[model samples]
Target chain A: MAEIRKATGFIDWLDQRLAVNKFIKVMMTEYWIPKNINFLWAMGVVLMVLFMVLIVSGIFLLMYYKPDIKLAFDSVNYTIMQEVEYGWLWRHIHGVSASVIFLVIYIHMFTGIYYGSYKKGREIIWLTGMALFGMFSAEAFSGYMLPWGQMSYWAAQVITNLFGGIPFIGESLVVWIRGDFLVADATLTRFFMLHVLLLPLVILLLIAVHFYSLRVPHVNNQESEEFDFEDEAKKYLTGQKVESKVVPFWPVFLSKDFFVVGVALTIFFYLVCFHYDFAMDPINFEPANNMKTPAHIYPEWYFLWSYEVLRGFFFDIGGVAAMDIGLAAFGFANVIFMLLPFLDRNTDHVAPAHKRPLFFVWFWLLLIDMIVLTVYGKLPPTGNNAWVGFGATITFLVLFILLPIITKMEANCKCNTGGCK
Target chain B: MRELKILAVVIFFTAVVYWGVEPFAHSQMHPHVAPADFAFKDLGVNSKKGDAAKGAETFMSAGCIGCHGVSSQGMAAPMDHASASASFGVVPPDLSTAGAIYDKNFLAALIKDPTKALKVEHKFNESRPHPMIAFFGLGGDIDQEIADIVAYLQSIAPVTPMSDKQVFADACQRCHDIKYDKLMSTTDKEALKAYMGTVPPDLSMMIRSKGTEYLTTFINNPQKQLVGTSMPRVGLSEKAQNQVIAYMEKVGDSKKAEREDLGYKLIGYMVLFTLLAYAWKVKIWREVH
Candidate 1:
């Protein structure tokens, strides 16, 4: 508490008023990250970079983009692309970043899962991160409708229609959400407001909470190694680096974060320029037309997995509608992410998935099933493709449903260093 | 180095997923649609070498200029665009680029029976006649008369290397519009909807929506791409078809060349940054472990 003598002039004045030095020291310089962590740990900074990119590029696009049904299409296609100088570059960056950010998020989440990073004291961090994921998804879905293209229109229509699967308030809830009978002018304006204003503001708040929640538990290491953060950080700070198994957040750890971010931006810029078609669906190029529906309608690539789950239930049981069952499954798939901390029954051992055989199999199957569902989702859900999608959907359910059973058995197993009682 | 290996594995898995979801699914969804009768064998029409001079005379004597116009010859249709479209579902196109754009064999079939050539014969019968009156003859052989009219059109057509925009204007403007380019269909919108049973889509993003290959097959025969569609087959020649696609790319994807160029430069910047970052990171981490 008595470490620093009062500084002279403006420095002492500002420090006394704002406590800025103490805040920086508590948040940054004294923060401890495990030395066993890999470059995957840097995804937080990468996401921040992507968020800034989206916010800045989105502001530029909002300048010329029109939200009206009549003018929305042309304002983007003609006015933004043609009339505005270098608007395409901003759009390419925005489009490509919007797409790639999801990939980074999945990797980040999986990394957390693999190392048992959400276990014990780190539940808040995981919960906040998942909340951020949900917010970003909503932001993306809302932003998609602002373009008012064919895919944009139909995707909104299909998503909003999901509300109709509810038993009592289904149809009326949908009408209230859309503000119209069909996906029309009202839908566009409301989604524009969400994309440009409300959702982003919520996401920004969630990002701050997610980052702050990590300060207590600290970042998990690759081996699930636990140590006193104060001791390791003090050792590193006093220049006894070899004895410490952690690095200070400011200078050493950020060096790795910066390098990882550099690599990520390289990959991102490459896609923005050379391979942008990955995000830009050709079907979306045509303006929204209620009269002419596209031959095939599908959601964006990132949402394809759950979209497949929603499309998988083809048969109804007794009197209930099959669509309602599929809708429930879709909701389960998304909500399961938030329940990871509670789902696993093993409270004693916090170890990497690879150290637990059954959980290892579960993790890999979940990843593979997600990829399969995504690919099959893009294909028309008919004939053999329907069967594959069903199998993938069932596999995803089974994997999550098995998490409790597998972790319980691991908890009761004979004594061992990993995944044992 | 160990962390880099983990990254490599992740990159490898990502590449596999990308291939499966994108290029692989795209190929499965839109298989290549083959061209419809490239040789025009099903048409069953034979012709002779026509004299351009005789064709020019027949163009007038046969009263071809009554409804259709040859803008190259300073011939305009008798009616204005509005009245012509109202009366005949679409305004008769100027035949200036017809010969250059439309295949010669297709042209001859179109003149003989306009309905059969456009493959909209399904919509037409004895009671509902095609808008274009069939060419009977000028008190002479019917095939020879058609050949003469075709020759006159070919002679009037501009030579090779016409701009892509001109080719599309000459061929598609009668029924379609590109709002982005500020170009509208010459025919009335309601008339076009009545004629085709659906309003034609704007061509501004056609190149992106339907790629070069898809557009080629679609323009060659609409039925092959979208079965039971009211859109008639347009008989643009292979060269002219390519030109129309090029023009679409120009308007729809105007920033393509610039985007590609800037992408490479930015990637180079990224490479330089990565190298510098690698060195600095290595220097900083040397203090630990």
Candidate 2:
């Protein structure tokens, strides 16, 4: 750290004992980031802010939330909405934020994929990110059950019963997960614990690791240039360098982060205030009745793509259940995303997506396939939907599996040299 | 100066989020309210009180007796279950308890078009041949006809309050076995199996297995809900159907009313907290920026 003027008052007194100044300088004030990172890079910061919002709002909700199966829906619907001052707003914000956070994460993941942010040394960061995504999904699902509404109860039943498709131990595992024979009061209580405490802690830990790994590699910019962080740190500590191709974390990037957050908040609050129920399923307003299943039970929009993949396998393969196969396929889709860092064998350090025509085609195809699957997933499993889901699933697998081969083929082709024509 | 500008923007946005956006969001979330015209008075022909004597006349003229017999003792149709199943893919249910089985709205709708009404209203997806064509196909005061028919059905069998056990025994026990609760004596399971081509599901948790709405609708017209099922339509009156539902509620979801009633208040509190939180966020961030 550079030597500077002595602190005059409270900060100085605290800094001597706690090293608060040094910590701030190292982590925030003097922390160097790539200058060329665009608005996509701002998503991580936005996600962090949203996570805090969700947590604080969630804590407030928990104050009056009843974890009992019979009373959970009532507490959320009646006491919280009517008795508690400002409770409806908190619940709506919490509910709406869950969806908005997923949206932000989707864009963040897409930005990562588009820029090859998972390449080489950033594999651990990418892996941690995927882990966080999984945790987020689990957290959202469990929190969804806390409402004990029609969708909440049935979605819980359907998802938990999915474990039964695992063959042996499936049934037992499902019972263990629910902490009961069925999704009753016990299931709600356990899910409440996981949603409020356990999953959030895991997510927090994974996030810390994600950021730590991210810092080492620095931010991957559009140019994708490499820099030696050790050398930069040495120059700064020795007081030899005044400036470089990097920007300080405080005034410049922090302001940019704040500005982006402002814009995001404006949009977020607009939805919360005007169209809060836009994403909500109206059937969910009805209290949980285990007997009557809703006509259509769809997951939150974020999980629709995977849910479609799961539902695509409508026919049984041999003696195995078709649902089991679909579940395996869904797992495979997530695994493929986690494996992207290893799958892309292109040795080029900074091959922008636009420059790689074949990969670009595959990327957009996969994106479109996901969107189509999501739409299909929302529809009842009719004959046309089954066929569309099957086709989309096939296209999804082919795109993922063929990417490496296509990348290899592009490497060998002389089309870029104007010789093939 | 830069920080102040950022803070000002944050504060402005925060205000917009709370003041400009919240009311609209609340409106969307809780849009439902009782209509201004809602009153104790009858609003239409459908709601008008019907005379049972007139209704009995309408029921016969509407060709209801062609399929449905007044008494539970015998079939009104010439063909029994075996032959009827072969022709319609399932024998139509007896309407002995029709007054106590189907919802009034459902009965009225079914008389119009058994196939189309079921599919449109209840999302019934079974693809069976429509045996009962629309009686109101002649298109002369169909609502009045339905109202009269319903009134006649109600007059014959007003919904008497029955114990959960009596409701299960009288209605569901013939086909279903209450596995958990021994409420009904075991029936001729084999004969029923031969007739329906499948054993009737137990009623021990039938209330839990099928939702209340589905049960009421299905009881009114089995073919409408499950097109080819052996179960025949049991045209119980609306009052009797409601009593059956109440019995089912007693068995399964006794806490439903209480649970649903609590939701409105819970939603109200959530709206208030959102505003305060927004204010707090702005206040805190003002110093940070």
Candidate 3:
């Protein structure tokens, strides 16, 4: 009887642990996806949703698509035109959502960058996000080829050729990548496999890590405090709390997030239903023919900024090989940006707003310059493009390096006045 | 530890299977002439002056000569070559006479648009097989090159035949093939008299009476052409109309499924999609949190 009673007691203890485990699991879910997150904070969730949509829709598309250059285009048409019911709709949804999701994520990243979301313990999350962005771009690049359209063919040709520009093993690397001498059946098949399967799997694992890292430290909403007249007056004169107060996560703050998500979804639905945002141009409907060059070759809008940058330096070089080398370096430099978090030297410095004023200012200036350069990147090829691109690059460096210092100075100015206290 | 081991084992097995299966299937499937690929390649090629000689050379050098005979006779269907003959597991039409019998423009249009070609040719007799397959649009200046080849074929003096439109109205338009099997062989005037004698119309100028627009529309959308008629819609091929019109504007006469079972299949899918959409909206599993 005593043994039975002890067993029961043990069972109760086990049940208690299980209950706690269940609670932790629930909390983790909400923690990873914080409630009452603003639309800006919801960028991670949006990216996650977009990734799932791409994978699932891509799987359905893969059913009818032939990935070889010879048959890839036809298979795509078959998916769109024949066989599956409403297959075109799925493909378009995947394509359009990709652009929208990435656009939101970029905004999220920049906002974080500007507001010092990468400061102190939050560096890991920002770093993971940048890595995800790079991978997302790669995913987009691979998926573009599955359509086997004119632009699809040329874009692959141009980008893959960039790898060949890497001295020494460049030519062999290109051959190895394409599985053929050119972007042919082998290239299409490989790209389709990667786009639909491999990249997505990697992205999912990375996202899991990204969110896990985010959960370690709750969202720092210091940026949400707008510069107000009252705050300014209090800082200079009375030194009272003048900014709009932060509400708790359960109700007030959380409801704002819900409203933003609802609005975003409504706009997304409108784009899907009425606009059908994916490109379905007549030229795109045509299959990729390697022998012929397309009239205009441009990357998708999200990559347009980088594409513009690359094109800006297309002409200026000491030699043909040197020009190619320059292009290759620019592409590599993008990947380097992903490593920024680890590269940051100064840490444990409080009042980043005051201490890093120059860094913040220059970062903002660099961002604007990059945007301007990207715009100029779209212009017709000319000798002057290089000069403009170089100037823009200089602007980029100044902002990236100086903005942190500017923000730090501002934070120091506030502290000295006893405003922070 | 046990669960982790099991998961590791499962993952290992999965990886092994994926690596083992993917390479073989993908490598084997890589080189084949997917119908879409063939169609798009054909579209990219200009058919106006298709030089059988130049095409023959390309066909040979591209490894097409291996399966397709030197004389242009095709072989068994393989990955690289799309054997129309191998389709339906029978001896199909010969290509040697296709240029002569079919209009040159029709051939070009077939290369441009396969579905449109099938729908047009399917009109003559429902029993006649149509080898319609997938098509991919192509890039490059393939059209001009194909035009050169087409010109070469024309130089060969390929024998041309009576246009399909001419033969159809004269020989087979009167009796509806779908409705009356016994009257299937009946010609236009006789069938017309049998059906409506007093208002019977002459078939010779019927094409001229209807303008190209009307004829094209009539040929493309036959359901809208003759209401309550048992004749299947054998749509007009763009090439056929273009070539036939150029060849002989002076001659030839032109004259004109299981609802319940198909409906159920369509309705079933609609219901399924609706339910799926509702499920996505509700996200019932998420509510547990």
True contacts kept of each: 0.76, 0.00, 0.00
* Alpha-carbon runs more than 4 Å astray in model 1: A1-13, A418-421, B35-47, B159-161
* Residue-by-residue lDDT tens digits, candidate 3, B1-289: 6435633643453344333323332233233222211132222334344566765443333342232232234343232212322232212222333444344554555544544543444333347433343223233355644444344434443355556554443223333221111123233333333333222332332333343544555444443444433333333335544544432233321111122243345445545544554454345223312
**lDDT, model 3, position A392:** 68
TM-scores, chain A, per candidate: 0.96, 0.92, 0.78
Winner on DockQ (1 vs 2): 1
Residues B1-289 of candidate 2 have per-residue lDDT tens digits of: 6446634743553344333223433343334333211111221225656667887778777776665556643437555645554554434555555555555655665676675544432323346345666676335576776777777776776356555455555556545664434454234555556545666654433454455656666766565456666565544455555666666555444434443454444434444544554455455434433
Q: Which numbered prediction scores highest in lDDT against the true structure?
A: 1
lDDT of 1 at B246: 87
Model 3 CAPRI rating: incorrect
Comparing 1 and 3 on DockQ, the stronger one? 1
lDDT for A118 in candidate 1 is 88
Give the poorly placed runs of model 2, Cα more than 4 Å off.
A1-7, A228-244, A318-320, A410-421, B1-289
Worst 10 residues of 2 chain A by lDDT: A412-421
lDDT of 3 by residue, A1-421 (tens): 2232233476466655565545643453222222222345545555555666677877777677776776666565544443357665566567667766765676677657655567577777877788788788888889877778787989899989878877799999999998989888888888877887788888888888887776565565543232333343334233222232322232333343444445455555445444432333334654566766865576665675566556545444566653564575476458656655544444444233333544544555655665555544444334665577666655654444554444445445545432132
TM-score of each: 0.96, 0.61, 0.52
DockQ by candidate, in order = 0.74, 0.04, 0.02
- For model 3, the local distance difference test gives 0.51
Candidate 1 residue-pair clash tally: 0
lDDT (0 to 1) per candidate? 0.86, 0.68, 0.51
lDDT score of residue A134 within candidate 3:
79
